[model samples]
Target chain A: MDRPASFLDEALSLDDGDSNNLQPWIGRVVLVEDCVETNGAFVLHHLIKRFLSPNLSSSDSIVIFVAFAQPFSHYDRILLPLGDRQGEGVPSKEAKRDIGDMDWRDLVTGLELAWVGGLGFAELGCNLVVQRENKRLIFFDMLMLECPDDGVEDGIIALYGNIQKAVEAVSSLNKNITIMIDDISLLEVAANGSTKDVLDFMHYCHTLTTQFACTIITVIHEDIYSSADHFTLPLQMEHLADIKIKAEPLVTGLAADVHGQLTILNKGSSDGLGRWKSKIRNFHYRVKENSVEYFYPGGRT
Target chain B: MATNKGRTSSFSRNFSAAPTSSIPGLKYGPNGTIFLSSGVPDLDKILGGGFHLGSLVMIMEDTEAPHHMLLLRNFMSQGLVHNQPILYASPSTNPRAFLGTLPTMLVSKDDRSRNTDAEQKDLRIAWQYKKYLGENKPHIEERDGKVEYCNEFDLRKPIEKHLIMGNRVECISLLDCSSLAGFRNSCSKFLSQLPRYDGNITSAGRIAIQSLCAPQCEYFDKEWDMLSFIRSLKSMVRSSNAVAFLTFPASLVSPSVSKRWQHLADTLLSVKAIPDEDKELANLLTGYQDMLGLLSVHKVARFNTQVPVILDATTYSIKLQKRRSLVLECLNQAPVDGSSGSSYGTSGSCSGSSKTGTLDF
Candidate 1:
């Protein structure tokens, strides 16, 4: 008998013997809310790995990653096993052996990276992706591109058009596509803090999820927005998302056994018909050297 | 032959002659009503199915906290979606940032396929008709076998491709005016340049002025100039077929000056952040409290005869929900203890009673 091809299935199975009860994430919008005290990169990395894991039989599945806060090289290091080992200053020989023992290498094979904003990072991302075979890269540098004489509307239109083209190019594969926007706040800044424009852009992205049967994951830092006006966008997005996951550091110091908390609110079931009764779960997690461990709040119990 | 001649004369009289409608740019809604969409459907519902043509809408907001800008964005966004030309005059707002605030139109695969299929079918039918009519082509603008009134604008997508392809209507005009005179001049120039007709079909445009007096307060040497500017602006709006929105910073101006401006507008709306003490009281009374602000509709034109004045002067507690839609619940009655107690349990009952006692102030 064959196992189900879902990284969420495998990942949840490792959740302290509460495997069979866990629900799988199909095509949905997941919001990862991060605060100043907590870094959500590790959780995002884990999510990407789960989506790309070899256990998922769908080899054709694609991952479209839009980077704003970080460069391609930064993501490449976080995603690829080779880059991960190199970051650790491990010798090349041991890194090769470690790669064979894990599924991380196969997990990043289907990544398509996009860089928006300055050309410095986009160029760097392009070069990095080009070194690897079958990897796709797209870049939109506002500095180099001439905006319409009228103003930013033309530029925004161009940016959206490029994204549409990229999505269309991969549509033929008929695979489970996941579009991850690393940080929406950066995109808002790039758009000159126009809350409406950003919200509208996300609405279009939401449309794509239904039209193409794709999943979207967006990361937003709550700390960036202080005023009520600034807070509205994130609040609006939280309402729009199907799944809301908030990550914040524990009140105790980082040296404490439990480092942070991950609150997952499944807004609705997989079918979306069961929205009236949604489920919310919390887990205390710790980021180790090469992996992350999720445990109950007060030990295994 | 005698009957046919009579019919021909009647057809020519109706078709060949100019349209005698008094309003030049009147757009008929889905319900065949002469109303313009406020962008947010909920708002449109509240304002008696949208703003009446040639009426001025004035939004007053706290000078320190100008959150009413979001409503203005929604108004402008609706205009763009309907392909209505917008004349945006502001001194502080960045054009790029303003453009960025528009929401994109959702385009599904089915819609794309259906649109293309429909276009091709329309072309074939038009060609056959043209062959039958022979030489007397209609005055309508035809492209790819279909007649279009004006280019449709989709905020959800990038417009560069449409611009590059040509024939897309330039819809937005951003004017950066520093002085009162400059603002008036820009408004006149922008309004004059707007197209009155889209191939014989009447079309309307939107004029939005951000903080009418803020710029004047900074640049104008006298307050009378600001008052005169508002007077001219009111007359201009009344004369033209365009719907105008003017926002004022309440904190910057005196009560009497704002009252005068409010009197000039057809519809007057004020949005203010709830005070901290009231918010805490509300939270204590209601277990789940997220309402952030209060919106008051001081006056509404055209509803003076049809609807009661009391209904027009209602207050709504504004709650921005998770779905991004602004929910405005009418604040009709004072908060009572019993209802709050049942929803919040024992602790809620205790706090609710205390809050109600303090409500006498």
Candidate 2:
């Protein structure tokens, strides 16, 4: 990665200069993906640990996705040492039907360990799961299997139905939720849905944002194929996001010996990094925790 | 010269240099000490938290043979350390000596360890790329945290490249002390001409004007009136925020002759020859001590070390002018009797010590 232009670095260092000005949405939600840090999961862990602004309310929540560079099984070992597991007391679907409503703490802890902890929930790698409370809501049940004998139309209907059900469950819980999907492109191809079907899915997402009153964030890889799939997601929805940030490759002095660059992309247009637009005079920027810091030579302040 | 005459005529018409800002590329702080972060802590701190962008920093030593060229060399190292562009003006000393030996000496003594302390977050990526691709031949000292000079070509290009790659610093120094005579000869004509925005001396460049010739010289008399000439030169240096070193021989020029010169300066310090050549370490220690002395005066800057003020037995004599004793007593670290409120002696220390800006070495 090349050093950025001087003006850009200045733009980064130049203080907003307005102290009383309130930036309420600055730390409302953080999107951590695999970029510059370890893998996507490790990036999410770092963001959780280094969330900026110690003043952030506990009520605030982060949305993360472990959507890069490994099979779910591989990440499970890493997550285990960190103390996280998915759905401990709350039964899986089979036991949920057997036992009504498990304790909420169990569900929360379970989700924390799994989505926030376990990092190996979707081992089969086909399903998109949500960890709210202790329960793992399997949003996409069809693990990446070769096309089902029931055919592509049935798969689309099944996929769409599961998504609707998951959205409804998240709304009923009244908890701000982060939905983690593993490579939306894989989901699109797996749905075997026509372009119209995918468009309908995007429209449904818009409806979910309004009806649920919850934040919806997606982590998309910037790979050419995945980016194309991400494009199919509605442009209007992209604008609705409060923030969109990008994580690019970084090279530091100590780590100068390392090889390769890491790139993390956030689908939310309103995240901290995307808000800045170049100006001749001044601009505004909010840095995320663990984000690269650019200091002007004699401390800028 | 004709162009200068045209400019003078134009200036007589319009006072403003241009519609744009006077100090272009200058960034200002609240009280406005120019913050030059060249990514090196030592250089930055040595410069009182970097150069004051719009303030004239005058570096002076007794005129005559020595001049403050060595001090200017130390100053130039700050520019090289950060890899910023330098516009060297060598009219007196050999430019080649500056170009060759100065950088080599700086590079040689540089403990590679210090470079490691730089913001290393980005290097992680570069090294990672090197590891995966097997393209970069990692140097052994890289682990020790040293940034080896990639090559002899303009250091600024690589630094700018690094800055473009996410490292940024603005360092520029001018070695022009030897050119004092030429500049003085040309000043009348140069002043007459409007300073071309596109001229060789851009607004952002650093300037070192060494060997300030004695006022009685034929050159000084023909160029301009003494007082206004001093004021004009000071004004130019101030406007550019250039670190200027004005050299005058202590043996030749009497203090009584130009007490007014000391009046215009913020920090008045003298560089006395150190007796122990080996202990003194030639240019670096002498240069470092004077810089430390100047830094002691500037209230806006904070220093990491308590500077030692020792008179040079070889060059500085208390018996001659008592000037050295006056400065030492004023800035003396320990308490002194009967000298508390004296005009020459200041209660100089780190904090709550004294606000006085005079130091004698």
True contacts kept of 1: 0.00
lDDT of 2 at A262: 32
Best prediction by lDDT: 1
Report how far off residue A191 is in candidate 1 (Å). Answer: 44
All candidates: TM-score: 0.38, 0.27
Q: Summarize candidate 1's per-residue lDDT along B127-228 as a digit string, tens digits.
A: 345334432121111122111211222333443333222322222222343456666776666667665433333467788877766643455334444655
lDDT of 1 at B77: 61
Interface RMSD of 1: 30.0
lDDT of 2 by residue, B1-361 (tens): 2443333234322322232133333322211123333222332322333444323344445343242444455444444543434434433335434444332222332443245334433433443343444311111112221222111112222222332223122221223323233454443233323233232223333444444444434444322133234444544444343444444443443432233344333333455433434432322222223222321221122111111111111122111111111111112232222324322222222342344223422
Full-model lDDT for every candidate = 0.52, 0.32
State which candidate has the highest TM-score: 1
Question: DockQ scores for all the models shown?
Answer: 0.01, 0.01
Q: RMSD per prediction, one decimal?
A: 29.3, 27.8
User: Could you tell me the lDDT of residue B25 within candidate 2?
Assistant: 31
Q: Is the docking of candidate 1 incorrect, acceptable, medium or high quality?
A: incorrect
Question: Candidate 2: where is the Cα deviation over 4 Å?
Answer: A1-301, B1-30, B36-47, B62-67, B80-98, B104-203, B214-217, B220-227, B241-243, B266-268, B277-361
